[model samples]
Target: MSSDTQQGRFEGKIALVTGAGSGMGAAVARQMAAEGARVVVLADVNGEAAAAVAKELSVGRAVPLDVADGAAVDAAVEDVVREHGRLDVLVHAAGVDDPEAKQLIADALVEGRPPEVTDRLGDSAWRRVMRINLDGTFHVLRAAVRVMRPVRAGAIVVIGSSCVFDTPVGYPHYAASKAGVHALSQAVAKEVIASGIRVNVVAPGPTETGMAARTPDVLRGGFADPRVRPYATPEEIADIALFLASDSAANLVGAVLLANGGRFTA
Candidate 1:
């Protein structure tokens, strides 16, 4: 636990975090537990990974989930509510960046070849990214909303990408998916606020995570500039996410907070 943790900030809160197997999702779970959440359900596609992180928490449980599967997502959320009685917080962070496509573009750039990544993009690649990144978000968000609506009290913080604003040449599909997430979050926020649910987005840029680790050196060279920091740590992003999920951000709803370390000011 960090010294700065709000100590019991989330006491008695029941929280659910998707993608909790690693990266920002795992960080959020840890912090929520440290802050005294009653229970933090860690859901991920990788059951073992989620269970590993669950062991680190005082009140954590692991649930294997494929966010792309709407039925499974709904069941998972329903199960949490049924077991815990109520859900107070939701952090939807499960997503993909399509490392294979990125690698292809990187190789082309290195070899001085036309990197027509989009032109060569097959249906499988495009659909896979959309299914996991965009469709999965919808599945999770909708499920959370269904339960939270009746309770008339909840907080949702979605992990979006700065790529949505400043398009990345290597990841059109990722950018598009995140854009949909941002828009969906805002729209849903408006609908749910009257019912006492708060929804917001954290759009981060080049975070240091497993996803970023897979990025080729050719594409990661920009981070080498000494004038600017390379990437935000998972903890840093988690801090913002927790803030949105906490009472501290009560005034925030449908807001997209960008954590790009000044990488994109606009």
Candidate 2:
């Protein structure tokens, strides 16, 4: 670990990070580039954001992608592998919470209202969250596995949410999607272990991202607790992700490495 960390950890590796336009996804892509990845595919639904990030990286290519689009995901994966020969690492961070649903949940938290208030989530909100979070993850995983399987070597890191553990009442869809992610990652890990492909999840608590800022102050204030201190920066989450993607975590397949700031006891 020291040898690589001191000398470009991912040197020569070809890495792809979904949701690389902003937040945790963008941070992971930048970290990989700095660590020496030969090329970092910065994929995001927002083309402008992705391009901005790619422009800043020494080794990066921006690709507009909506993870929910299976064909797009497959095409992107195919292009990356074709151009680079192999994809050594994949980071899936593209996801979303229905704005209405998210705000309703946060309001419930701020007002100290009963959790049942979130039961009003409409069909569209539920579907939107599910499509982006769960189905999107499936699309990326399917595409990545198709290529990495034959090569018999690759690493995958799925961005999950700590909210899945305790189950918050207001955002059932968000919780459900993340829970599905954890299950999917574990199941895929077991199925692909023989192929030497590793799959893992990194569940972060409240992060210092634009999304977190929009949430209720009551929720973001958790960062003020002495025990939790400061909110986690995107880079902090990326560090854990890079560790799981690196050989240092060789034996840590099918694991959920929670990076929450101790907000929940379980």
Q: Which candidate gets the maximum lDDT versus the true structure?
A: 1
lDDT of 2 by residue, 57-118 (tens): 98999999999999999999999999999999999999986556656656777778865544
Instruction: Estimate TM-scores for all models.
Output: 0.97, 0.94
RMSD (Cα, Å) for all candidates, in order, is 1.1, 2.3
Tell me model 2's lDDT, rounded to 2 decimals: 0.88
Please, what are the lDDT tens digits per residue for candidate 1 over residues 219-238? 88856767777788999999
**Clash pairs, model 2 backbone:** none
Instruction: Tell how far residue 142 is off in model 1, in angstroms.
Output: 0.7
lDDT of each: 0.92, 0.88
